[model samples]
Target: MRTAYRVETVRAAEAALMARLPDGALMQRAAAGLAGACATILGRVYGARVVVLAGSGDNGGDALYAGARLARRGAGVSAVLLGARAHEGGLAALTRAGGRVADDPFAVLARADLVLDGITGIGGRGGLRPDAVPVVRAARGSDAVVVAVDLPSGVAADTGAVDGEAVRADATVTFGAYKPGLLVDPAREYAGAVRLVDIGLGPHLPSVPELEALQHADVARLLPVPRVESDKYRRGVVGVVAGSARYPGAAVLAVAGALRGGAGAVRYVGPAGQAVLARYPETLVHAGPPGRAGRVQAWAIGPGLGDTPGVDEVLESDVPVLVDADGLRLLDPAAVRARTAPTLLTPHAGEAAALLGVARDDVEARRLDAVRELAARYGATVLLKGSTTLVADPRGDLPVRVNPTGTGWLATAGSGDVLSGLAGSLLAAGLAARDAASAAAYLHGLAARRAARGAPVAAHDVADALPGAWRDVIG
Candidate 1:
């Protein structure tokens, strides 16, 4: 699992570690790591021109000290100070090592081979300052490979929201642990690639993190493997209510996902029963309403269920229910909150925006905030699907699960339906709402990546690849 801490947590940990170490020891350690990373990026550092965007505080100090190391190694390093006062000690060290502060920031930036963005640290908020805007633009516009100090400037360290102009780095060298911003999107999109440098602050940090991404081993632990005594009934039956006459493929796709989601049997109830049976004859099909769909451990409702009456019946069931696609549209907040059973709502940006009564752009820009708000408003576990899928629980105590596995190929239609069915089946297999949602997303994204393999993949391919994805994780 890849865990990330909030800025406050990181600062507190840093302060505790710094108290035990000698004066300037921690900064030097950070600088050494930063310089090593810079050198690795610039293979031939002997005559490499490096520009450091130095700002106020420790971030600037790290950059300046790193520039000093580069200067000593025979690289021509220039510091473009963006604040009123640079790190005095660091500036002096850089000067002594033969690195000079450049008066013409743009001229040097335009000709630089690499740019170090220390313009803001994790604590800095609200984007780049006015004076630093042109320099950041020049660095980006140039051929320089930009690298951020901790995180890209102007991004919300905790929430991963970018409100204004921000530095877009080719790579980011983060210290100690990963910040929440570096894992989630908007800010993640700005940070091209990330490398972590250990500064020995692990012991000072807390056991629980602010956010977590489950890897293969973590998912393997969470996945339910059938026991010797397990039967079809004991393993769990997933009820899928999906597709209309207008779009029967949604039902087939959802069933495909549910079949491979570790559920023993899939009982599909909708208008598209004939279509589903055609593809999967083993599916127990019912042409009647979802109320008469018989026994099921959990119910997956709403992929292509266009204005259907079955949604209300499924929501009223005592079993766990997953709401997605058209079901998201017909959701009554009061009804959803009134339910005694667990409810999971999976919505893409547009669906999420409609649920919150906000613009789609607003939802995309602040995904963390949006997912949490949706979970609270709906009084259920909410899965906000996007480039970075997030699962947030209504209780708000647990850290939001950030899904790290995914490719652009997952944007295909019906991909979300597949996800909904898979997660619902997990719920049937007795995984908690948060665990089910997060695990399903991890597999779904991995399956998509495997199926696509640098080409476009249809939604069916992703669903078919789920079994392989599960095997890979467990093995």
Candidate 2:
């Protein structure tokens, strides 16, 4: 798992580690790692034109010191100080190593092979300073590969919010630990590729992280595997209430996802029973209300359930439930809060915006906050689906899980319906709500990537690719 800490916690950890080490030792270690990364990016450092954008902060110092190291390695390094004053010690070292302060920042930036952005640290809130905007823009317009120091300037480290002008890096070299901003969206979009530099701050940091992204091994551990003695019922039965007279395809797609989600048997109830049976004869079909559906370990409601009246019945069940699509529109916060069993709500940006009574743009801008708020309000685990799927628990104590695997090709009709069924199946298998949501998202995104492979893919293609993704994880 890739874990991220808040800025305050990271700052406290850094301070504790710095106290134990000798003066300037920590900064030097950071500079060494930064320089090594820069050198690696610029394969042949000899005569390479490197430009450093330094601000009046420790981030600037790290960049300046790194510039000195590159200068010693035969790279022609120049510094453009953007702040009122730069790090005095770092500036001196750069000059000693044959690096010069650039007289024309724009002229140097235009010709540079690589640009190091240290214009603002993680603490920077609103955006870049007025004076630094043009210089940052010039660096961006250049053909140079821009690398941000610690974090891209102008993004909130805690919330991943970008209020104004921000640096868009080709890659970011963050030290010690990953910031929440580096993992969450809006800010995550600004940070291209991220490389973590270890400065030995691990021992000093807290055990619990603010955010986490599951890797293949982590998902493998969470996935439910069948035993020799296990029967269909023992494996887990997922009850799916989806589809309608107008849109029967949603039921077929949702049931497809459920079947691939490791469930033993799927009992689908709705008007689209004939369509579902045509696609998947294995499914146990029912005509009316989901309450009459035999026994199920979990219930997956919503999808193409236009004006369907099963949300209340499913919510009343003791088993875990997953609500999505049209069901989210008919959700009652009071009913969700009243449930004893766990409930997972899956909502896209537009759906989420409607639930919270805010603009879709607002939810897109502050995904982390929106998910957390919705989870708290409904007293249920909420999965906000998008380019980066986020799962937030209602208690707000556990770290929000971020799905790292995905492609833009996932933005298609009925894709979310598939996710709803997959997550619902995981819930039926007895995984905790948070684990179920996160694991489903991980698999969903991986399957989409496998199915698309740089081409367009339909929702069923993603569902079809689930087994391959499952094998890849547990293999």
Candidate 3:
């Protein structure tokens, strides 16, 4: 799992390290990595023009020392101080290395090829102060490639919350571990592309990372596969309780995802019963309710059972139940707790807000917190869907799994239905609730990327491409 840490904790750790080392060793190390990234962007270290937006804290010290390195290489490096008093040691290092200091920020900024935004780091409290606002705004409006030190200034480091204005960088080069804001949204959108630089602070970090993201290899290892002797039932069976005469397409899309999923058989129960057969003839459709849907390994409820009633019976099924979309609207917290089988709740921002009784913005701003809160409250694996889809199970000590293979194209309607079906199928296949959800989200996102191909696609296109995605992962 890839992680990001908070700035205050990082500062405290740096102080501890400094106590054991030479006076300026840690800052020099941070400066070395920062300079290397600058060199990479500049291509030719000696002739490139670099502008450093220096602030009052150690963040400025990092940029200043890096500027000194570039100046020695013959690059015309200039420093613009946003604060009244810049780091004294860093300022001297820049002067000694022949770097120029510009009193007029506008004149230097207009000609730069690259901008290093060190105006604020983890320690920065508010948005760019009134005076520094134009400096950052001008750079963002310009064409220069911006590289932020540690984290983009003005963005909260702990919660990924940006209450005020923040810098939007072309790339963010962070030291030690990553900060949660870089991985979560709102702030995540500002961080165009993220790169982590190790400053040897990995040993002292906590076992339960505040946030975690899965890479391709990690997903490849966790994905389940079939053995030669495995039978159809041995693989898994997912029972689907969805659809009403009012919305038959929901059942079709849900079955589309489940049938193609690794599940051995898909049993459907609901009002739009026959419509599920018309679209997915393979589905074992039944009249009445999900209680009479016979035997199955897992159950996925609430894709489109709106106001038709009798959904309570389906929700009580003691199997690996996945509650989603329409089901989320009428769900009772007490009924959810009565199930003995592992349960997974897949909610987008609005649904999560309804489940937790908070505003949508609250769920979006603190997504990591919202997801954990839902897991503890519902006592089920909660999969919060958005830019970084998170899967957390309440029964285990597992950290939430953030899906890294997602694109904005996934915002299409009915995409959530496909996800619930796929994940529910995996649950019946005997994987842990977290594993089922993380695996399904990865494949669903990958399928969306492949199906869209830079264009818009319908929900069925996503399900149609699942086999290709599964093959790409397993083969």
lDDT of 1: 0.93
What is the Å distance of residue 6 in model 1 from its true position?
A: 1.5
Ranked by lDDT from best down, the candidates are: 2, 1, 3
| lDDT (10s digit) by residue, model 1, range 377-415 | 989999999998999999977888999999999999999
Point out where model 1 deviates above 4 Å: none
**Of the pair 2 and 3, which is ahead by TM-score?**
2
Model 1 lDDT, residue 432, Cα = 87
Clash number for every model?
1, 0, 2
Name model 3 segments beyond 4 Å from true: 12-16, 395-397
RMSD of each: 1.2, 0.8, 1.9
The model with the greater lDDT, 2 or 3, is 2
Question: Per-residue CA lDDT of candidate 2, range 39-76, in tens?
Answer: 99999999999999999899999999999999999999
**Model 3, 110-198: lDDT tens per residue?**
88888888888877776778888899988887777899988899888877778788899898888888888888887888887887877
How big is the positional error of residue 397 in model 3, measured in Å on the Cα after superposition?
Answer: 4.9
Better of 1 and 3 by TM-score: 1
- Clashing residue pairs for model 2: none
Q: Over 4 Å off in model 2, which ranges? A: none
